[model samples]
Target: MSHQRARGQPALVYRTKTIIDARGHQVAIVDTENPTPVTAVFVPQRSSRAEVAGQQDIDVTRMIVSSDTPEVTSWSRVSWDGSMWDVVVPPAYHHGTRHTRHYSIDIRRRPS
Candidate 1:
């Protein structure tokens, strides 16, 4: 199925990286500069309980983005509905003859 025909919604992708601060401390920085506006569909996979002391509920969702989306990596995250989801692994890229057909990434709700 073509991506254009799919039910796509607007999503923001955030790229994060580790950097050394002036105090010689390592810190992670998140950049939203020139954020790529991609159309994606959020499909819920399953919910599981966290193993931590709080036993928080973790929601696993699959975000299917357009093939044209760029700069997405495991270090990237998606923002939707005032919630931030972390990309758990490398995205699965589906390529067509000329270009990428679609991309799928598994994201999980950030543990509080």
Candidate 2:
């Protein structure tokens, strides 16, 4: 991607915590610590005619950011527009001559 196209706005990264209640049920909670600022491009998923006809309305967003960002795993969550998206897969790294240039992560909106 071109540098101009690659430049993206700042976004927030969140980490989740799982707590077992007194009843032994697992409860997941989002940490309230200040979010990490990362430059990322959020691209909404495009639906084809067949996908639309099949009644698939899954809204997936692809977030592209620098590969050097630390602790960005599949368990990481992205916050945008007051909603959280789950990291759907491992980060895909793009390598240059000596180091990675960027990484892309696909995120799907968490169901309500």
Candidate 3:
């Protein structure tokens, strides 16, 4: 059996994608063809609410650091532990040594 890493957990991220539909209408949809699999390290964050320019108040719940940087955008959502969390912003990539190469992602719990 493979041993699980204490700092890394399996996670899924749905990157933002656009495609043309039947009527030649372009539509933005979550790329489900292949959910990006990533090894994420969960970061504890205090729940906070903030309002964007015209959007409603958003409660940011948690964050995750991953070594992989897919096409995830601010509109992307992360599915973890059977729950979906909205990406708070564009994935932030930190440039550093090989061991520190990772992306910092903030996410909010999706409202029911």
Candidate 4:
């Protein structure tokens, strides 16, 4: 297990990721440099809403703004699943060149 700190918060973040299709089926497994603390399955769009709605395992800290030429937008939510605060990148952002939907999990230290 790996450990990460989110800034001023004493909470530690454990990161794990699940990749699912639009129908909510696990399509691919996300490989990350972060340690797997707890496993959580996620759905795109709706999942972000759930976290914002305060119904799930993580809190959203920041939304990432990606710019190529036209400027693309992706969201990252920092949420604590009790043990760790995780930064989850949901499927709305295209992680693949040919794909528009895919998810990745990352860890961030809250800026002190």
Candidate 5:
């Protein structure tokens, strides 16, 4: 997880990065002046299906919720339904970033 402290705006939470394929030899540096805006969801515990479903009613492009347990390894993906957010969990593992209190939703574009 990363932190962004702008000049005037409040400190913002940034995304978490993991080394995908760092070879034993060379180092490739990617210069990104504009970082992608992300919507992070902080889940403190394991959330039930009902809890996840209830959140769909809100039009939150990026969201995260937590419970008292850590049983949920990944979160269900949420889609924009023109007016609100919709939850969709596919057959594959819906992995998200885990933090001290919640999970993060990383995307190239911010949710509108």
Candidate 6:
């Protein structure tokens, strides 16, 4: 009998690294070459739209539902629909009563 937990890999998540420049200033560089590929989906949060409704704030929020890559945090970023988004909060692991699990990460649109 096979007893392997099924995991899916569907998308790529880009991450940035902080490095000190010659002036000793920290610089964040995005690693687009070696992205972390995982099974994740960016779900648009209703609160995000409602919050920005009739407001000057252009920020759009989303919940990244992933079955893997629990390490993804506020330091991570994702490119979707030709725009980059920044993670706004840490991952929230949800454990269902039936033993189901997933990671919920809140992300906001990166300002230009």
* Residue 93, model 4: Cα distance from true site in angstroms: 7.4
What's the CA error at residue 5 for candidate 5, in Å?
23
**Candidate 6 lDDT, tens digit per residue, 1-112?**
0011233324557777778999999987766676775555556563433355465434655554535563565678876666677777777878654335666777677655
Model 1 stretches astray by more than 4 angstroms: 1-6, 22-28, 49-53, 97-100
RMSD, each candidate, Å?
3.3, 4.4, 5.3, 13.2, 17.0, 5.6
- lDDT digits (tens) for residues 1-112 of candidate 5: 2232111121122222333465655433222232233343422222223356345222222334322222221222232222212232211223445433443332121234
| Whole-model lDDT, model 1 | 0.78
Scored against the true structure, residue 60 in model 5 reaches a CA lDDT of: 25
Q: Which regions of candidate 5 deviate over 4 angstroms?
A: 1-24, 28-32, 45-112
- Which predicted model would earn the best lDDT? 1
Q: What Cα-based lDDT does every candidate model obtain?
A: 0.78, 0.72, 0.70, 0.32, 0.29, 0.61
Give TM-scores for every candidate, taking all chains together and pairing residue i with residue i. Answer: 0.75, 0.65, 0.71, 0.20, 0.19, 0.59
lDDT of 2 by residue, 6-28 (tens): 57777788766678989999987
- Candidates arranged by lDDT, highest first: 1, 2, 3, 6, 4, 5
Model 4 misplacement above 4 A: 1-26, 33-58, 69-112
Query: Candidate 6 regions off by >4 Å?
Result: 1-11, 23-29, 46-57, 97-99
Model 4: per-residue Cα lDDT over 9-76, one tens digit each: 23222233567779989753323344323222322332232346545443234322221212111222
As for TM-score, the candidate ahead, 4 or 6, is: 6
Error of 5 at 63 (Å): 8.7
Report the number of the highest-TM-score candidate: 1
**Which residue pairs come into collision in candidate 1?**
none
Tens-digit lDDT track for model 3 on 38-85?
767766565644556655545564454645557788868888867888
For residues 1-112, could you state the per-residue lDDT of candidate 1 as single tens digits?
4554256778888877778999999876667675666778888999987688866888989988777778677778888767888888989988875434778899988865
